[model samples]
Target: MSIWSESTQSRAKEILAKYPEKRSAVMPLLYLAMAEDGWLTIEGMTEVAEWVGITPAQVQSVASFYTMYKREPTGKYLVSLCTSISCMLLGSDDVLHAIEDESGVPHGETDDEGVISVEHAECIGACGGAVACQVNYELIEGLTPEKGRELVRWLKKARPDAVNTDEMQELFGGRRSFDWAIQSDVGAAGPYPAFEPYGTATEDAK
Candidate 1:
């Protein structure tokens, strides 16, 4: 009797098939569901659990583990900035300050307009890029003082009065990856699945 939509139910089937154990798909399913609906309601989890043939407990546990599953709806742009050792050493603190100063919102707080949410992250795994921040899961790296400012300026100009953009464009200095964000993995990138070069980010963009 759980009422998941036709599309979500179809995706649930695909996700379940990807895993030998149905339990393993719980997290990704919850993530997809939440991405569609914004927050992980108990009702939604129960519906997804029933679809995946897993206990509600499994669904709940999985949802709780990833920071991406918002218990509460977040801003239009969720900015997760890396504060790890490499980023920290490379002036991520100043970067953090720039973001805070420009956005006028404290870390872990959402702006009243609900346009952006800022939070600290452990690592984004782009150590070679030296410093980075994510806007709605798009990784922008090789941040210089001027580049960062332009990014902020550009974000402030987005329509619906948004402070983030969908395209993510290029860095102010252009693609800095050399092969920029490029890597090889049996003719593909280690972290990239679709085999595109000049693209990377450490985590799930969640």
Candidate 2:
């Protein structure tokens, strides 16, 4: 009856231990929830709030502020096409339409089957690879309308082990592995709380 499975809950403890305070793990825990459910469901956020000693509303506020976190269900693969200035000039708009037509899923929405979700991204820092598209955020550069269509089809049919590309490997590597606790360092000093540092990009330019 809990949003997190027993194993996931155990992992949450590990995540908590990494920080000086449980609350510091909120973002990673949110990612854990998203990684587990493929999106941040209400129940998932509630569970994370409980784990991090925060209110559900606080969790929701943080989740809503971040574009990377999805509040609804997403397909197994999330395909994001960049449509920024450079990408737009390079025909990413056509590429986006091609994917939309082929998948029959509109931008910012997932298909009913939950196999694919499509969205337009501002700039994924790949202007050199204009018309860039990513499958689950793994870069797939050098895209054309036709190539985008084929890429989606390939993703829908490709088997995890049958693939050898680094992108494919990373995308499927931990599709179901939600063991965030294992990566924590428990020996560190207590109160090693995580902090979100804020600084302007130009600050380091001098």
Candidate 3:
């Protein structure tokens, strides 16, 4: 049986059609696969290889090269705290420790409940924002240690189906890289494809 659902397979066909060579569609197809499984499973990679006319090893090579691709299973929310020079100077390390205290896990580990995964990220291009982090790639800037702890505590307690970026920024953000448009009800569960969570009412409508 194919790893892709019918809709995903159809989408894959459309993505493949965009490229002259099937192998050229590997990246997008991998994104689709990741969106499907929430991570890059061996079976999904094999199916992608079959679709793209490439070896599974080749698919693995490409997937490994990209930081966005989640090779293992991640929690429902992936929290990436920026620890680059700018964020570091602004006390991101303290924020990270606060998050660790609240989430009960160190960076690069998921909480026992599997609700949140915390990791330290390199520069996420929000230097102007200083201390910044992303929840499933949605930027939240200007976090202090207290705010970080509060954010994690809220996430654990609320377990919200949709995490509104605008709302999060309004509540916890102090500085910003730039002015962002209000995004209502938009939520992300991963780092790729920029889509709402797969089975949400928003995604279902799309």
Q: Which prediction has the highest TM-score against the true structure?
A: 3
lDDT of each: 0.61, 0.67, 0.80
Q: Find the 10 residues in a row with the least total lDDT in model 3.
A: 197-206
List of clashing residue pairs for candidate 3: none
TM-score between candidate 2 and the true structure: 0.75
For TM-score, candidate 2 versus 3, the one ahead is 3
In model 2, the worst 10-residue window by lDDT is: 197-206
The true-versus-predicted C-alpha distance at residue 77 of model 2, in Å, is 0.9
Q: For candidate 3, lDDT tens digit of each residue in 1-206?
A: 67689988888888888888899888888878877887778988999999988899999999999987788887777889999999999998999999988898888888776788889999999889979988877778899999998889888887765565777788788899888765556566554535522332233111
Alpha carbon lDDT of residue 179, candidate 1?
Answer: 44
Per-prediction backbone clash count: 2, 3, 0
TM, every model: 0.74, 0.75, 0.88
Q: Using TM-score as the measure, name the better of candidate 1 and candidate 2.
A: 2
lDDT of 2 by residue, 38-127 (tens): 677898899888888789999999989988788888876778889999989988899999999999999999989887889999898767
Error of 3 at 140 (Å): 0.5
Candidate 1 TM-score, C-alpha based = 0.74
